[model samples]
Target: MGSGHDTRVAVVVVTWNSAGVIEGLLRSVQGSRLDGSVRLIVVDNASSDSTVQVVRELMPDAEVLQAGRNAGYAAGMNAGMAAAGDCDSYLLLNPDIRLGPTTIQSMLEELRESGAGIVVPRLVDEFGALRLSLRREPTVLRAWGEALLGGRRAGRFPPLGEVETRAEAYDRRTEADWATGAAMLISRECLARVGAWDETYFLYSEETDFALRARDAGFALRYTPEAVAVHHEGESHESPALFSLLSRNRVKLFRSRHGAARTALFWSGVFLGELIRAARPTRRAAAWALLGNVRGVARPSS
Candidate 1:
C-alpha cells in the first residue's frame, strides 16, 4: 500500500541500563542528517541512571517513552512502536548503536526496491570491525554451531555485501533466514500483518522468533551492506549458574515451539559444548538473564 519512496520514518531504540553508551548513540544520531521526516523514538526500560534524562535533554525532539520498570526488550519496543503509529517503515535500533548518516535513507530506498518485509544494515564496531547482522534461524544446529564453533566469528570477515556466505543462500537476504534486530528497517505492511514483537521473549531470541514468523508469513528478511551501524555486543556469561540458566532458557524456547525432540538435541549439544568452552567472568549474570527469559515467556512479564 506504500508508494515509491516514503520519507516519513520512525526510529525506535530500546534501552536498559545503557546510559554510558546511549549518550554516544544519541549524539551520533543527532549529528546524522537523516531525512527531515525521520522521527526518533527512545524507549527507556527503566534505567536507574540518567539515561532517560540525558535522552530528553540531548534529543528533546526524540519521542521518549519510559517503561516505568526494567521491562523486557520486546515489550519496550512494542510500546514505542505503538506510540509511533504507522510509518512507511520503522528502524529498530539498540541504545549503543551508532548509525551512519545515510543508513536510514539507504534502507528506505532498499525497502522500495526489494519490497522485502525487513531490511537490516551492516553492523560494525567502534574499531570499525564488521559484524554479521545477518544470520540463519536459531535452530538446534545453529545454536550448537554457535556454542561450539562460535557464532559471531563472521564479524572478523568483510561485509557480506549482496552475496551468499554459508550454506546455499543462508541468511544472504536474497533469501535470509533472519536479520539482527540491532538496526533493522521493517515495512509497515509487514508490521500490520505480522504485528509487533512477541512479548514472550525477555531479551534474546525474540528477533529470531519474529524473523521465522515473518518468513512463514511470506516475507523475506534482508541484509544490506549499504546501510551500516555500530553495535557494542554485551557479554555477561561470567557465572556458571548464569550459563546454566541461559542453557535452560534456550531449551525453554526450543521446546515450547519445536517440541521435546528438537529441544533434547539442542540440550545434548550444549551439554557437550560446556566441556569444550570456558565460561566468561559474568557467567552468573548471563545465566540469571537466561532464567529471566524463561520466566519472561512463561508469564509474559512486562
Candidate 2:
C-alpha cells in the first residue's frame, strides 16, 4: 500500500454528452481533502455536447483525452486509465456523483488499513436517501429468489438474493462481492493484477466483472460508509434500451462464469422477474426489451 501522504490517486471521469451533470463531480473532486497528490483525467466519449469545454473550464490542469468516437463506457474508462500513467490508486467516477470533502481520503485510508484491493463509498441519491449499492455474486439461486420473492424481500436473506438492501449492512464497513460502479477506488496492486476493465460490456456489469475477477485474484472489495457520495442515478431505470442492456449484461456475465444449464436457469429467473413486473404500464417496455422486442431502442454510445 502507498503511504498516506505519498499516495498518488488518479481520478478518471468518462463523459458522454454530460456537460450539465459533470460540473458537480468536477467541483467536488477539486474540493476533496486528500493528503496525497491527485491527477484528474477526463475521457470524453465523443460527446456531442460541450462536455470537454466544461471540463477544461472547471479543471484547467486536468488531462483531457478525446476518444475520437463514441466508444462504450468500458472502452472510455480503459482509455482514461491508460492515460492516467503511474498512480497509487485509481478513482473511477461517474459524472453524476458528488463526493464529500473527505470522501477520497476516507476511501484511501480504508484501502490502506483493510488491505482491500477495491474500496467503495456509501452512496445516496440527490435527496440524501441511501441507495442500495452493494451486491452479492450473481447466481441461479439468487436469480430465482428475486423472481419469486422480489429483490428487497429476497435480499433480506443473503442466500436468496444478490442485492444488499438491509439498512444495517450500510451502517458499518463490510466486504462485498461487488457493488455499484458509480464511485470506487482501485488500488495500484489490484489494477496491476486484474488489468484493464473488460471492454466487452458496453456499459453495465463491467464493474461486477472486474470486482469478481479481483476477488478471484485474492483481493477483497471493501465498503466504507465513512466515505459518502451523492449519485444522481442514470437513465437505466427509465430507458428501455438501457434497461434491456443491463438485463442482457447480467445474463452474459453469469454465463461467462457458470455452466450452460445454470445459465439457462438464471436466464429463466430473470425472464420471469421481468414478466411479472410487466403487468405495470411503466415496466412494460423493459419487459418487451428483455424479450428482444426493442424496436426503437437505440444502443447507447456511451
* Residue-by-residue lDDT tens digits, candidate 1, 118-229: 8888777788777655665446665566555554543222231211234322323354777667887888888888888877667766777787788889888877777778
Candidate 1 similarity to native, TM-score: 0.80
lDDT for 114 in candidate 1 is: 90
Q: Quote model 2's TM-score.
A: 0.94
The Cα error of candidate 2 at residue 87, in Å, is: 0.5
TM-scores, one per candidate: 0.80, 0.94
Best by TM-score: 2
Alpha-carbon shift of residue 149 in model 1 (angstroms) = 4.7
Per-residue lDDT of model 2, residues 9-128, tens digit only: 999999999999999998898888878888999999999999999999988999999988988888988888888888889999999999999999999999999999999999999898
The C-alpha RMSD in Å for every predicted model, in order, reads 5.5, 4.0
Q: Given candidate 2, what's the lDDT at residue 90? A: 93
Least well predicted 10-residue stretch by lDDT in candidate 1: 155-164
